[model samples]
Every structure is written in structure tokens, then in C-alpha cells.
Target: MEQAAKELFETVEEYFQTREFKQFFHFVDAAIYLAQQIADVAKEIHLLLNKAVAYYQLGDSEVAVKTIRKLQPFERHMTASQRIRYLNTVAAIYHTLDDTAHYYEYLMQAYALATDMNEEIALLFLEGNLGHYYYEMKEYAKSFMHMERCLMYCERLNFEAHEPYIIGRVQYINTSLELGKMAIAEAQFERLEQFPHILTNHHYVLAKGHYYCICGDKQRAYELLAQVIRHDGQHETILSTLYERFLHVAEEVETLEQYVETLETYYHYLGRLKEAQAKKQIDQMKIYLNTELLEEMLWHDPLTKVKNRRYLDEKMPIWLDEQHSFVGLLLFDADHFKQINDCFGHRVGDEVICLMAERARQFFSSESAVVIRYGGDEFVVFYSVKQLEGIEVMLAQFHAHMQQCAFTVKGEVHHVSISIGATVVRANVPIEVLLEEADRALYQSKQQGRNRYTQFQQHA
Candidate 1:
């Protein structure tokens, strides 16, 4: 029976590799039927998991979730490794469903189990997955941390010949560039030179393009990036990333013609990508709406319509755990907020808070920064800072923008100012300590002057 099951699984795997998804499903169904007939619990669980993966790949996440839930009763029968695989499968389904919170949740669970078992390959895979997740989130520091771990593990396990090790190297190069770690990126690029075939690999090409672009060789960067687009333009995520890189270099280059041409190409690709994604999301939404598992509004702040304290509370620990090299936290307190409420009424105060939230949102890139309405008249902004100068420039821009904002209540002109306390989080610091330090800085800022900003000083 085991031999028969193995043969059937091989056929399913072959169909999957051939991109014959329907045939893959047919084989999986047959395997499940055989397992049921033979009353092989282990075989049945395996086939069911495969079926769930198929559903996830087909973008039927609702069905995938139901299929995975069917394995709950067999949880006690699963080995630790099998349980880890099960958790990862569920995480992948959540990722397909666009449920980032749950995706991270399950991935972390699997990571913990893998760590406890001291499973080198499992740890490497989880680290790589987490690195990609943070990379997509534009949390470059955290992304770099995980990708660095992947490289370390690859070397320790002598997995340099493996495909994932190559991919991990590519990702590390890309993320190191993002974090402005040019030396690290260049070292990784040289390492890739050992693998001649990686020169033509799309990810390697893209990373090299970014490295060159950062090193002030826009022409070479453009050539490599153009090659990537020509070969892998259909991949929306890759195209989007290339488009963003184009936008970044557009400002630094003296010539506009080539940049404009690349922008046009990127715009065309992005339009097609967005259209396809929109349709897919619509279909996903229909499935979600039909099911009883409606998403909750727990993460959003009602008044400002931004992320709430709960969201920040949930995410901050993950960022800290990843040990980002430079995490910047800014605590903003509306200056004289009580006076505004007393003078204009609570409704007007609410309007001011909303406007302030909107301006805060404008000051930071949505992909990299998180703005939370921490409490009444206080907002917290947390973002990964690639350089100290970047944080300074952002602070200056934020201060200037606040000065420009003017509000009118009952035809009376009013100007508002915010006291900001900023701090760079260091490695191994507890989140509570980080917050306390920022709060102390905020108090100092208020004491010095309500309208100014203060950087946290450990001695002061």
C-alpha cells in the first residue's frame, strides 16, 4: 500500500511540475480515495495536505482552509516534522488569502518548532520565507537580519550547492542594497560570481542592477534591469520592484530621456499587472464574502482611520525580534491639544486629529512606515531607517510640513504644532524599554518647547 501511495504521489508531483494542475488534482483525489479504502491515516493526511496545497495554488483559499481544518483531528498522530509541515502549509494558504497577520502567526509557530528541533533545513527555509516576507513589507533591516541568517545557515550546513542558498544570496544582496550596506552587497555579488549561471538569473540580475544603480552606474543598472524585464516582465512583484527602483534613480540621473523611457515601460507593465490583480482580488473577495469567516476590523483606528494601538502592539515585537539594525520610533504629541478641545469643541478637535494623521501619513512611505494612533492626541510612527541622515531629513521635512498646516474652526484661523520625541532602537532592547525611552524623550521635548522635536539622549 505504501509503495502504491508513493507511486501515486510521484505522478501528482510530475503533473505539478508539468503545470498540468487539473491532472495533479485528479491524482491527489485518487490518492485520497485509495487511502480511505485502505484506512491508512498517515497516507490520508498526506494526500489531504496535498489537496489543500493544490487548492491554495488554484487560489481557492476558502476551500484550502476547509481542507486543512479537516486535519485537526489527526494532529495527535503527526510527528514533529509533519506538524511543522502542516503549519507551514496553513501559513502558505493564509499568505495566498492575503492574510498577512495569520501568515506571520503560523510561520512563526513553525519557526519555533523547527528551532526547538534544531532542524537546519527547516530553519533555513523559515528564515528565507521570513526574509522574503519582510522584504515585501519593505522592512529592509528586518529583511536583512533574516536573509543574513539564511546565509549563515547555508554556510554552516554546506548548502551552497542548493537552489535555496543561491536564492538566499540573491535576496541578501537585494536587501543589503536596500539598507545601504553597499560593502555587504558587493561581497555577496562577488560570491555569486562563483556560480556562472547566476549571472543570467533574473533575481541576481535585479540585485546586481540595484547594486550598480546605488554605486552611481545608472547606465549599467538600466541595462541589467532591462534584461530582467525582457525575461521576467510577467512577474508583477518583480516588475513593481523594478519600477520603484527606476523612480529612485530617476531623481539622481542627469539625463531624463532614458529614465522616461523606462518609466513608460514600467507604467505599461504596472497597468496590466494591476488589472489582473484587481480581478483576482475581486474573485477572492467573493469567496470570502460567501464564507462565514469575515475579517475583523481590529487593526484599524476608528477616529483617524489609520492602524490602531492594537496593530502596533501586534507588529512591534516581530520587528524587535528580528533585530533590525536601525529602527526609528517617533512619538508625536499634539501641542496644547487640550486647549484646542476647550476652545473649539470636541468635534473640531477630532477634525484636527484626523488632519494631523493624514499629514503624518504623507510624510512617510506607506510600505516602510507604520503610523498608529497610539492614543488621544498622540500618534506613533515606526519605520526602518537605512541611514542616520535619512531620519534627520525626514524629521526636518515633518517639522516643516507641520508648520505649514493651518486649520479653521468656526471661521477662526488656527495653527497647530506637534512635539515629537524620536529615538533609534538598538539591538536586543525590549519593546517596553524602547517605548519608555521614546516617552521620556517626548517629555523632554515638551519641557524644552511644545512645538519642537527632541532626540533621545541616554545621558540627558
Candidate 2:
């Protein structure tokens, strides 16, 4: 079989050199078969490039990426700019892998290589990726910078068929919203409907719905939101948009009690909680943040900057409003914080707290999760594991990143481990109730060992 396959590869190579390639009516089957048999990735790449060029002329990038991979590289065959475009595609796959930091690293490399190669097209993709990454990371300045860069370059490249316009539009809306420019966000979102090739166009609708609802256009808000949900039949992205809109709505409107009611009704009618988790977390966080506008500040832990008892009290009220979300809280404390302070002094102790908090913060890289200071030496982390599942995978990758961050104190290097208690907040409970629930989980962590996670159970 090996000898037969080798003979086949040799025949295919000879066929590729024939005049058939020069003919307008090239035999695709012969060319394709020859391309597939190339041994070296580089030669494979040449074969793939021929196919890619063909696929591209056919206007099928999705197929191009897939077919291109089956072929190997051709040394110096493609321009440097072309190679950078290939790298950009590789970076995109990493982005889809859902590790923000790794995604950022690969994208940055692509951008640098593209710039060095003078590939404007590749740079445009890099800029667009950076826009979404920074937005997800909650770094507004970076997001805005990259988004504008993407738009400018895309226009220069005349990428009307690409997603440049739409990605820019969505990035603009998110950047404006984060910066508290609701009006700008609305306008940006309005532009998104007309923008071409946006993967997240439905999100624009939800953003408008949530913005109007929060701005007191209750009728328009509810109607828009309903439209958003209705569009779910046509688009799957609707679920994430609905979940985001619901969270923002929970913070702004009172009738979201009805919003929750409607969603709950649908969930039962549909019989699935898989999509409802994000809505649940948003509802609970809203309750905690809105707990008596004035007293809401009381529950937060100052040192760790997590929700304190006061925060928990406020959050408790809306915990079960959605019949599902009630996000789990990881309440963590540093064991023997006093020992570190006593050995290194108060200054060192403060530094340790900051360091630990910083690491805990990394757990929320995508900004979908909330990490807060519950009180002195106590921190709370609430993860909305809906739009993003696979928490364990995230944690595993996080471990690798953490190894690179060395915390130094008092002319010495000291690493601190935290005890985390994780538990789901029962539905309809207040933030305070959730905290208590999480606290019990925290105790279990301490009992089992100081430096780990323990889940709160039913009735625990």
C-alpha cells in the first residue's frame, strides 16, 4: 500500500507540470488530486495556493481556509503580505479557542508580521481582532484605537464584502456604551443593521433595546427586546443578545420582573435552562448593585473590592427572579494574612492582598465574570458561565498564564494561595443570601484544604 501510494504521489506531481494548468479549461480533478498528494507542507501550500486562488475567485473564503490547510507551504511562492494573511487566519482560530490572552498574543504577532511585510489587508484583520479582544477584556482605550484602525484600513483596502464595517460598528457601540454614551451607542447600533457582513448584527438590536429601556423608553424598549427575541427563530446569536439585554434591563427597569417572568415562561415552554444561565447571573448582579441605591455600597468588601454583606443583602432579592441563573459565587480569603503582615509588615500585607486580587481578577479575562472585594481580606467572584461554558478549560489555560506572574514582596518572592468557596445562589434569594450560601462553600474549602475551590451544595 505504501509503494502504491508513493507511485500515486509521483504521478500526481508529473500531472501538475503539464500544459493543462495553462489552459483556461484546466482539469480541476487532476489538479486537486495532485495538490493533495504533495508531501512537504511547503509544496502542499503551493498546491493549496492554486486551489485557494481558485476558491477566492469563487468567493468562498470558508472553503478556502479549509482547502488551503490540506496543502503544504511553497517556499517564497507567496508574497510576505500573503503569508501574513495566512497567519491572521491562524490567529482567528486561536481567538475562537476562547482564551483572550493567547488570542491577543497570536493576533499581536500577526499584526507585527503583517506590518513588517507591509500587508495592509492583514493588518486590517489584526486591528479588527484587537478591537473585539480589548472590548471583551474591558479595556476601552485599546478597543477604540484598534476599531478605528480597522475601519480606516478596511476602507483603504476597499473591503466592502468583508466584515470590517460591521465589526467596527459593533465595536463602536460597545465602546460608546462602556464610556456611558448611550446616545452614541444607539446610533452606532442603528448603523449596524445596514453595515455589511457583521457576525454580531443581532447584538446591535439588543443593545438598542437595552439602551432605550434604560433611558426610559419602556414601550420602545420592551417592543425592541421582544423583536430581538422574536428574531431568535432566524438567528442563533439571539440568545446571547437576549441574555445581555436582559442583564442591562434588569439594572435599569422595574418591570424586568416581567422580563424575567416572560423568559421563565419561555424556558419552561421550551424546557431548557442551558441558555438561561447568563440571564440569571445578570438578574442577580442587578439586585446586588441596585440594593437601595444608597446602601448598596455597604455589602461590598473594601480590601478585596468584592461584595460585602451589604452587597449580598441587596443581591439576594433578585437571585431567584429568573428561575435559573443565580450565579455561583467564589468567596475567597487568604489564610494567615496576619502572618504575612507580621513577617513583612503592614505594607507588605497590603501588597499581598493587591497581588492576590490581581490574580483573582485574571479569572474574569472576558469581562463576563465579576471579581469584587467583599470585605477586608475577602473577595467575591461571580461567573456567568452561560455564553461561555467550559470554565474548567479556562482555568486550565489560566494556570499557564499565572506561572509567568511572579509577585515580589519585602525583597523576597512569596506566592500566596487562596481558599475559595463556590456555591450557586438559590433562585429568588437576595445577594446577601447568596453570599451566605457562598460563605458556607468557602468554609468547606477551608476544611478540605486552604488553597482550593469547594462547591456549596443544596441546603448547605
Candidate 3:
């Protein structure tokens, strides 16, 4: 009888040490079954928790829930701190299930228990979890405060090793900024930027952009907004709001008011005229993204694109209008190009135009240049020249460069040249009128001599 008892103890010890549950047959085998008959429910509960964690990692949330439920009888046997921890794990499972109500309730219970037991780490995680729930519910004030405390706890506890906890600081800063709590938001936002891993994170950059927006620095806001747009141009709801807000604030500055007016005027001409239209576009964009009305809006130009127009409208306003000085626009015209369509096939003519457009793009100095087909054979080179006198000289160099390239059609080489109308923009000039003036100058170049560059005149 003693030998049989000794054999049972050795088998149970091996079962616990080996995680024999990895095999269904072993877990359900005669050995564990015999041990289960002998041992209390608490030891079973402990083993079940470990199994549940493994199942949760495998995306088997249902099974994890079942395991947790099966362990409920063991809760009475656990100590105070262990019970709190057990509840927190259950809360986390609810999170994976997206049962937000259960998640919050269990988290709150764990937080209460942890507070009662004086377990600081458990309370910190619980407070942060509850704050996330509140933030999702749009209860900004309390959410912001609790999250602020979570950030402080992470800081005080030296939790730099955990990235998500640090990111909670940025998340709260964004929530506060949205709520218009600028003073506290600014401090939180600055801390958020200093979070050691800000460079690569979307949330970090967005927090910084919102900081600039909230601080009423429209120039920096636009700049950062441009960066965000470049990195992820598809998130139009965010990009549109940032652009509109930047434009709104820029309009308020007396120094920028003239150029800002021009910027809106250009957008109006581009069919984004009214505040109602802008708002409608945003709403449509939201619906298109949400309801599959459009799957890939970013790739198609808002106006005309086999390519996206967002790339143009987001950046060119500031580039051509000169929020910063020393940028140039070279308006290019297809030489007697309209006559070609009237004489030759429009298909042949379109092929020629596309070839000419490709040639013009090859002359760019940086990623700063945007070549919009602007409608037909008329194209615009909206670019910034980093070096002085570089903007004007670029056209001459482009013309010289174009003189050498040949296009092949049906294996036949075709030569094409374009008239260039260039303009330098100052912050004082409105971008719409400036571009219009450049187009007029472009016409003058075509009349006097095709394949030549002309600078636009400033109206008094």
C-alpha cells in the first residue's frame, strides 16, 4: 500500500513539472485522473490558469474563458493578493474577447482588491486599463487624470522597459489635446515626445503634431501634418482635420492672412470651395473607408488620377505659396500640342503628351517637386530650390536636358520640346493668383517663342 502511494506521488510530481497537458492524451490519462481523485481543487485551478494563458496566446479565447470558469471554485482557496491577480487575468481575457463591459468591471474589481491589498503594480495596470475604457467612452477629464497618473507611475517605477506603458502617456496627451486642455496637454505632450522611442511611432508624431496645433503654431503644425501625410496618406480623416485646423489658424495670423486666403481660393478652384463641401468630403471619406464605398482612395487623385490627388493638394499650397521663401514653379506647355490632336490621332497625341510629361519629371532636384498634369498638355512643376538662384537656373538646365532625350513610339524615335513659364513665389503673394499669372506668362512664351522660359509679372 505504501509503495503504491509512493508511485502516485512521483507520477503527479512529473506531471506538474513536465506540463504534460501539451498532449491531450497525457493530460486526460490515468495518472492525472488518479491524482485528481486524491488532490484538492486548488492545485487543479493553478494548473488550469497556466493552460489558459497558453490557450489565450493561441487565440483560443473561448477555451481560455472555459478554463477560467472551471477554476472559479479555487478562488475561495486563494489568498487576497492571488485572488486580485486572478481577477486581473480574467479581466485581460475579457479584453481579448472585446467584452468591454466585463473588461472594465473585472479591472475595477481587481483595482479595488489591489488597493485594499496595497499591491502597487496591480493598481497601476488597473488604473491604466480603466483610463483606457474611459478614454474610449469619451470621458476625457477623468480619463486624462487617471492616465496622467499611469504615466507618472511608469516614470516613478522606472518602467522604460515596457513600451506600451510609455505609450499610454502619449495616448493621454492626445486625449487631453482633443479635449482642449492645452496647458496640461502641452506638458504631457512634451513628455510624450521625450519617451525615448518617439521617432518611429505614429502616436508619437501625432502627439507632437497635435501639440503644435494646440499651441497655435500653424506653420509647424502644417509641416508636421505634411510629414504625417507622407508617412500614411491614407488616413484622410486625421489628415483633413489637421489641414483644416492649420489653415484655420494660419488665416488668423495677419502676416499669413493674404497667403492663406490664396490657399483657400486655390482649393475652391480645385472644387473644394465651401466649408460645407470640405465637411462633406470628410464625411464621405469616412463613409468610403468604413463602408467599402472606396477601398483605395489614396491612390486615385481626388480630381483626376490614375494616381492620387491628395499628394498634390496636401503639399503644393505651401510649396507654391512660399510659407517659406525661395521656392519656384515652372509652368510647362506642350509646343503646338493642341494642334497635334486636331491633326494626328488623339491617341498618338496622348502618347506624345505622356512622354513629354515623363521627360519633365526627370529634371527634378528633390522629392519636393510635384508634377501635376494640371489638365492636358499643360503641366506645372511645383518645386522648391534649396540653393539660391537654383530655381531659375533649373529651367534652363531642364530645357538643355530635354534637348538630348528622345521618345520611341512603335520603335520609332520622336522628338518633343516644351515652352517653360517659371515664377518665384514670395509669402506676400497669393498662391492662386500667382499660378494664374504664371499660366498667362506661359502663353506669352508660346506666342513669342516656344521652348523658352518666362517669369510671371507681379500685379501692383
Per-candidate TM-scores read 0.52, 0.42, 0.40
Q: Please report, in order, the local distance difference test score of every candidate based on alpha carbons.
A: 0.78, 0.59, 0.64
Clash counts per candidate, in order, are 0, 34, 4
Q: For model 2, what is the alpha-carbon lDDT of residue 197? A: 35
Model 1, which residues run further than 4 Å from truth? 1-6, 13-20, 57-63, 134-145, 156-158, 178-180, 231-238, 247-264, 270-460
Clashing pairs in 3: 300-308, 301-307, 301-308, 301-309
Ranked by TM-score, top first: 1, 2, 3
RMSD of each: 27.5, 24.8, 30.1
TM-score of 3: 0.40
Q: What is the lDDT of residue 78 in candidate 3?
A: 78
> Which 10 successive residues of model 3 have the least lDDT summed?
299-308
- Model 3, 116-192: lDDT tens digits are 88787777777787788888788888788788778777777878567657568777877777788778777865665
lDDT of 1 by residue, 1-460 (tens): 7788778877876876665665665456566655654446777787777777767776788888998998998898887877888999999888887899999999999999999998888889899989989998999999999998998999999999888998999999888888888888888888888986887676777688777867889878866666666776766656466657656765566368866776787778878888878887675555333332222246777567678888888976786677567777888878999999998877578778877888899988987788889999899988877777676777877877866556775578888888888888664667777688889988998899788888886321
Candidate 1 accuracy as TM-score: 0.52
Cα lDDT of model 2 by residue, 116-228, tens digit? 77778677778878888888889998888888788788778787446566656667676777778777776666556565533235656655665665577866776666655
